[model samples]
Target: MSGHTTTFLDGLEALAASPLSPALEETTRLRLLDWLGCTLAGAASERARLGQMLASAGDGPAPVIGTGQTVAPLSAALLNGMASHVVELDDGHRYGITHAGGPLIAALLAMAHDPRMDQARFLKGIVLGYEAALRVAIACQPEAKLNGWHGSGVFGVIGAAMGTAVALGFDRVQLNAALAAACTSASGMVKAFGPGSELKPYNAGHPALNGLAAALAAEAGFPGPEDILDGPHGLIEMLRGSPVPPGALSVAPPYCIETVYLKPYASCRYAHAPVEAALRLKAEHGIAPADITAVQVETYGLAVHKHDHTEIDGPYSARLGIPYCVGAALALGETGMAAFSETALNDPETLRLMRATRVTEDPALSALVPAKRAAHVSLTLRNSSEVATQVDLPLGEPEVPLRAPDLRAKFADLARTAALSEARITALADAVLDPQTDPRTALSDL
Candidate 1:
């Protein structure tokens, strides 16, 4: 357990034998609900066509979410992982600066459907997976980003491995092997965040696929490096240029998923504050798109660093740009799923506002990173009037949680967008919220 990667294996293996905490279980259930909505909403996008095609063709045991198709656990995880983050509304951990749910939950649910796994095992696996992924990301952070690696794709492979291994009931040695093998399988391409080429979520799909393969291979008696995280060219040294911290692998009650933020805006997590600020200004001042002469967003490092695309030609770019999100929120009072379509990306007024908007990094905001993802927005009106606002935490953070009814409403909205019937939506909600019910059944209906 004192060994580098062995610490993660020991912590997860201990958690696997323990019963699920009631609070953590409820949080996981809600997260599963939110992840499902995002995945279904994204599944209908043209961006999801490649994964859908693969799902339709890769026939296996696990179900491929919306299309009524079944693929192998690995294939199902791959497709679901891609589709879940296509809309950029998945659950994110602020501390990790990464999304914990999309790839982790995608892999967990794929294995949970195997009938051998019960609700308890499935929930515990999710908890274990989230902890491993977030700790790895946090340990490798700032450096992982400085090295041009995407946290979710790089650390998420390890997270997916932990979850999949637990769900399959792997022993400590097998779990360690799975994680060690997954260490080399990590892929976090920062270039995928570019506008036209939509590989952001597709990069996530690789980890989900690779993780499942690692766990299965380890279970099949495959051998791998023992101290994958402590060796000379290990994850911590190679990725973060440091030794792995002992405290990162230590377990705390409630699990990491309880600390994650459920996204309200369908944009980068960094842009969420400005979007909230813009909406606040819109509500208080009734500012229309045409009435504004200039819009400027002063946010943290991750928000304004390279997210300066004022011209949004597609959904991926639209989701990544602070200008577009702030402009859309201020002008339209919301930056929900409706603001992400091809037509919405090409909207004349939206483009006009985007062109008028500028984003900059505020030192005060940057200092608040891994704590409160703060941002300040100042808007200049046609009459030369200025309005400014700052948000420390956006709508759906742990401090500012979405109400149960509102979360239900959000799920309904996404479900209706996918054209689900009223009855089906209700059934879906019931299955996810009720921990007694098997989540795979709810997914089957999706």
Candidate 2:
């Protein structure tokens, strides 16, 4: 690969071979904890229950996050991955526009079942997995999303395969073959978000299934195009409609995982900006939802394209509707899980505000995407007074991260919702954060 034509695998190889710094390791731990909380919380959902049924065929030694069930490694990976993303509370990368942790960590947990896996190796696997997925997604860039392809579904298989290869101690050649196999399996559509959105989590689940299958196939001496990611009709070219850009996949330090945004609210990441803007206006002006005459939200193009819906059919749909999120945030002073609950969905006041909301694209803000996921909100009150607020980024982004206490509280709340004892919750949190803790023993309680 040439200077500007650095391929995704080239970047993946460099990232895999690089030394893991303390900061990278720390970020891995945080991501693990975050993924765990999301998985546990979502485990109770009907979508997760359906996933569990679909994956319950084989028996093996892999824990299904909050279900306290042991299934085959591949099944566990699929179930946990789906559960983690069902609530839309998983960590997201702005540049990649994908949720890496769902597929990557879900596969890693299943791989960690091996007695051979240690804490350092587990952490390294996560970093490499995130690097693999994020690089591929970055290479695809705006084109992939523009084509209606979901990054998590398309790139997640790569992430899961890369991380699993690390845990299995694959040589470079095997890893390349595995990635090639994964590339062939990549598929997802944005239509999953339109209606009957309960199937949305399947996009997250299938990555773990296909990725593990690819890595295992490669491990068994299966062969694939070694240059599948950069050669003729490679994954990047097919997804991006062009050759890889210069330095598109060059090795950079402080890997993508370091900057992943954790979702403080249980809705789509695209909706968070509007929700934050609405909440800010509500907090600043002390205007009740009933007093609001109209609500307008201006955001990036992708956000408007994907989330402008106001006709929410259920909680899942509500989570994707920017209008519902902003209206709910203003009406309830919050946009957490409660805002998407059945009760809130049926609330007359929330519906009234949702109907009054309009979401439009701001070209200036749209140009800043993959760098700044921003939104601006303007609320007109009963007295014809106007209040406005702009949010450059939602909370839980690295720059506007949740405080330590807040992170802990989020974990605790999610665990409790999953029916985990307070003691188990605390223990799990401590174990995940401690570098010395054994991956197997730390999760014994679960």
Cα deviation of 409, candidate 2, in Å = 1.8
**Best candidate, lDDT:** 2
lDDT value, residue 355 of candidate 1: 93
User: Can you give the TM-score per candidate against the true fold?
Assistant: 0.96, 0.95
What are the per-residue Cα lDDT tens digits for candidate 1 across 1-446? 35657666767777778887667677778888998898888887743575546735556767767777777778888888888888888888887878878888888777876665677778778888898888788778877887788888888888888888887788777888888878888878787776677788876677887877878788899878788887569887888777765666566665678888888888988888988988888878887778889988888877776687788667788888899888777656558887886667767788888899988888888898878888888889989999998899998888999867878888888877778899999999999998688777778645
Give the C-alpha miss distance for residue 284 in model 1, angstroms. 1.5
TM-score of model 2 relative to the true fold? 0.95
Residue 153 CA error for candidate 2 (Å)?
0.4
Question: Mind giving the per-residue lDDT tens digits that candidate 2 earns over 1-446?
Answer: 33322355566666666667766666777788888888888887654465547465488888887666678888888887888888888988888988888998888888777765677677878988988888789878789999889999999999999888877778877887888889899988888777765777878888988998899899899988656777558888888888865677765766788778888988999999888888878877778888999999999999988688878899888998998888788777667778877889988888889999999999999998877899999999889989898999899888998765777788888887778888988998888877677555665446
lDDT of each: 0.80, 0.82
Worst 10 contiguous positions by lDDT, candidate 1: 46-55
RMSD to truth, every model:
1.7, 2.0
